[model samples]
Target: MVAGLVLGDAWLWVAVEWSPPAYAPFYARGGFDALTATLLVAALVKAALLWLILRAPAPGPLDRRAKALRRLLYLAVAYNLVLWYAFALLPDAVDAAFQLALWTGIDVLYLLVIRWRSRMLRAAAGAMLAVELAGMVNELLDELDLRELGSGGVVGLGLTLGGVAATVITVVGQRRDGRWSRGTQAAGWLSAIVCALAIPLDILFGRISSGSLAFPVMIDAVGLVITVWHAATARELPAEGRPAELPPARQRVIRVAVAAAAVLPIIALIQPEQTPHLTYTGWSMDCYDRPSFGDLKPEERDAAFLCRARSTEGGVPPVFPDSLSDQQILAYGRALCRTEDRDERKTILTRAGSARPAWGVDPWDLVYVCPEIIGATYPELLRSTKETEAANAAYIAEKNARCRDPWPRTKGVVQASANYFLFVDGDTGYLVHDPGDEAADEVAEQATDKVYDDSALIGVAGSAVLIGHFEDVVDLCLTVKAFRTPPPQRTAGWDEVNEVPIVSRSGRLTVPEMGEGGDVGAGAPMPNLAIAGKGRYRLRVHVRVDDAGEEQHLVVVYPGASRKRLRLKP
Candidate 1:
């Protein structure tokens, strides 16, 4: 019967290996492969040994009950193999369902087999069946995502209750039988109790893999111990109860087959690899480009200084005085604001602000004020500053208020202020002026290098170029800013740097126009820009144009380290 069980187990292994996602070792490695193959081989060898054992003469006559039970065990093993094969051929959903059913059936059969076979085997098998049932139940629950009762929680409770009940029953039955010395019965009961106690601990804290065949493994271990003890102490069964035994040669052959079956799946998993295709789209830019302040000519410095002053005044456009050249403006801005390293700043002043706003303040003033506000709100904003409990509470309250009513009517004023400060901080290349005085030159240099390495300027062809508008540029800029400053950590005060203005290229429809259009940018307001520290992050942009009779476009961008892009469709 052991041989037959082993052979059936081997067939089960063959079934699992043939199923997809293709068991290439490159994809699936470690214990998953090892255990799978081991089980397979063990099953095959056991079957071969059983056949040989059946061919050998029995030690003595057997009772009808014993013979009947043996036949049923063989039949159950056969049925299990058929079910396994069917599972392999079915679709994934169907196969999963079938496997679940099959395991449940196997558990029932195992319990019956143990009861009719040997007391020790029965106990071992019963324990294993309980564990397997617990695992299966847990797995099924997980697949359904019934979070109220998690798989681990349910399995743990079930195993604890079942193990205790089984142990109690076994103890009562053993005591009644009086088949062994009192000491032996005591030891058996003690072992059973120990196993019962271990079940809950293992379920709660054991590093056991969730939904794995841990119960079966425990049962197997216990079964082995019981089998060895029985063989050592008990002589052959009484003449009427004696069962058939495997021949020496068949037993050896079975062992060899089982070993081979166990190893095959693992070998299959170690196979080769394959290549996959990838794609990307949308506007991406780097924020660190520091202009050289030291080499700036006197006239250029004058222009930059004037631009900084005007930017701080709040309403003046990003323009320098007529007396200073573009170079001076660039240099002065870099020196005053520490943002000279970022090319975007240069571009914004030189090209975007060519017309210049009459009331806008200089960029340097905006940069200085921005950091001060951040620092004041969260003192820990300063580099290396430890957060105090009072500060943390104040920060949380501020953040909650901001989140609840994020959009203020004074957005234009705030943006103007931010732009002015940015201009002044260009040269220092640091976001804020700190007492430590660690220059942001390194960050600036790295940011500049990344921009040059990854970006390219491409002109749009035909009439489509006309579609681009000032609002689009503004949206893109805001998006870039948001990406540069990710959301603050939970323990830290809320920083508004994550907020980015969402703008429509046409300017006809503001964010309030979202979902009103059936055009290119319909539905909810899109998040056109995003900022993240590390790991995969998403940026969603939605735009709507009423002129086109309800047209909208939704753009989704996935950005990763090294500036990799993945564009998802809406």
Candidate 2:
């Protein structure tokens, strides 16, 4: 009965007092919440009690009737034990490798406890049988199987296999040894029949806590022990005859009580938990815990999701954030977005230099990707202080060792204005059109294109050019240089390499009439790059996103002409 009380305590606490989200602090490692560990201490206490029971002196051999009643207790205990095991393995793996190890340990413990109690080879064999007798019946009730035990199927199967094998063997061996008892076999089968009530109760009770059922069973268990003791000790009890010797009404009452004690906890154990153990697997910019994700591989589901959590799954994303700290980066992004002036925006984003933490998003990419944080009420959110400056000085010393190189960048934007190669939809590279080519307008209408679309490396989706990105809002280092002839080819240090056509119809490398892109540079002063005249030209764009996510774009526009799309590397 004390053992029953201890087991009941865990269910009661979880059903009433335990809040999975409230305890998230204890379990959420990175984005993972290992809910199974929540009940570890309780399980240990239960194990301790069992250990004590195993060490305690054996009671005298039971007469047939007493042994039959005891078997019912064991039967209830068995059902509850398996239910507990199912629950223990309910939550999906937090760390797949670690969870697999835990699975082994927990399963072994389940078998050991059952076998130690039965102390027979048959008991050891029964440890593998899962509690499928009730589960198969679960299909008939609502047509839904034990999804409650999602992903825990293997664990349950192990238990059911072990339990059935051990029980069957134990019965056969005991009978062969001339020591088999009909009472014990009857108890197990009867307990199973009682356990089946879990289905109807599940339907009727709907979504209530297991406590509703467990507490009652605990009460019944206490009453049964007391009543049976009183009956046994009565001064004028019959020496033999089982229930035939007792009053009919009392016998019926005892039978009912035994049934109640056997079924209630088993029913309670299968009751749904308030928060099912969740395993999230997918590419998410935020956290998600659902059953669907359980179908994905551990690595796929466990990929670092940061930025912000979203309810809907995302499309092929530009980048999936891996870091947890985005507060400062968001503040910086908002500051850059205060005005539409492109230059000013760049100034604000890169103002902090090493003083600002990249937080896994380059400031340029933030202007497009994290557009939600732009145009905030608080623009100058986190201005640097004297202390921060000193700290940044220390930080830059280490950061610059690898980030000091410059490339042919946004140098003297010869013609930041694009009359011929206009700002198309998804394409952002230099483009040229024949006398009246409407390819730009036609493709622009297909998808919402971001100018600085940081979709990993630059990709050609329709007409838009997608670019790769830095880890965070790190400042870019650029050195734009013009070339009359094609620049010498350098094969290394480029993350993306693509070529786009730049048309100069009247033969002059001056700012052309670039159609309004409705983007950041709308109100900004234009900078012009002049390094050519007349005829067609091609801009070979070489991009580098460093280890820390800082970006550098090398633009070398030389005299050339091509209508075909060309992409060498990205």
Candidate 3:
């Protein structure tokens, strides 16, 4: 009856773990999906302990006969546990801690066997038991009310029963008894060997060899038949005295084995490093496969990304918080994009984000992690709805009216260097618009620095002495904008608004026609300064972009450099 019960539970574990009921809301929610696999391994370990008890002579100084076998079983279980957790992906705290505890306890128990007569073994054994109990309790709490129970047993029930069996049987195996203890010992050791050998085959070859977990399951089936034999035979091995100590050379080998076990995992963690996982509060976006990232719609992008990021054979990418739907993912993506503070931009956040300095938002992963989802999805968001379109359109027109000239059309995004803010302020690129009709970089160097930041979102259009000493190349669109009685400022909605003093030696000058190339030129292939003849004119240059700024800054030119850079709007 006992053998049959063990056989049934073993089948339950393999069946449920291999094909988890992921349709259930709580299934695979955390590490819960692999609960059955953990249980299966536990059952095999327990069976090993049973075999050790039933088929061996009474314990005395941890027999030399199976010492090597014990070490092999331990190594196998350790490897299998590591892989199982890897398969689980985002294991919770309890799952990780429990596995660690189980590993430590098994090692400690093995150590006890090697030097069983050592007075220190008693304390080490107690410590192992304590660690196991704590692990059991931690797991029990994690699964409380989370996992539902039925025939196979899972979550709290499976783990709890395994814990109980480990505690009770392990205690039973410690005794020096007659016939019964011998059979229990034999059963226990055999079960461990079965598990040590079978699980890895199941994981490594099960699917490829038989297209299922037939490898491990069959090994388990063979284990059950042996159990039946053990039950019927009822062995009576005689108790024996403590065996002689293992040779010093053999002991040295055992110590080296233990040291290798400890060093291997640390090396693995060090090489490429362990991949970290993030548990999102709501949405899960991890898929990155796409033809063109920016082209896909937000929903489609989200449909592509999510789940601490793992590949599935078919269907949707596994949602991290699995309850999320396609539409909800979109809604969540929108919410994240729209989360720009109505009050302030993420300036401090940039400072706090990463130690590496950057002019853009790459260090902080609000959108860079998933481009399709929240990154490019909201580019046209201001005009997405009819009301938003009308309101944003009117607002843009009102802002642009400040610029006196037609909005300069930007050709493309120009890569800015580390001193981009310096260029934005007019130190490098503008002074005398050389009537020779080139932006005279030589003359612009004489202009004073007048860069100041207001941290304002939408500031008024308007600046002076906007010397254009640009690095042999300046995008005309950035230099000129719709300047009203004041000029239009292009803040790009998120970029900082800065103004600095600019001086022009003469009004009649030329600026480069900057484009997507590495060509060298001084000004716009060149624009008429329209500046009623430039001589000793003060210019406060505002380099900014708004959502509707058409990717161009509103360069408002005024007369006379300010004592300092001025804030154009409240």
Instruction: Residues 63-103, candidate 1: write the lDDT tens digits.
Output: 55444444443443443334556556765555545446755
Report how far off residue 291 is in candidate 1 (Å): 28
Provide the lDDT at 369 for model 1: 31
Which runs of model 2 end up more than 4 angstroms from their true locations? 1-156, 172-183, 191-254, 261-570
Can you rank all candidates by TM-score, best first?
A: 3, 1, 2
Task: Give the TM-scores of the predictions, in the order they appear.
Answer: 0.25, 0.25, 0.26
Please give the lDDT score at residue 98 for candidate 3: 52
List ranges where model 3 is wrong by over 4 Å: 1-116, 145-211, 219-570
What is the overall TM-score of model 3 with all chains considered together? 0.26
lDDT of 1 at 516: 25
Count of steric clashes across candidates, in order:
74, 52, 85
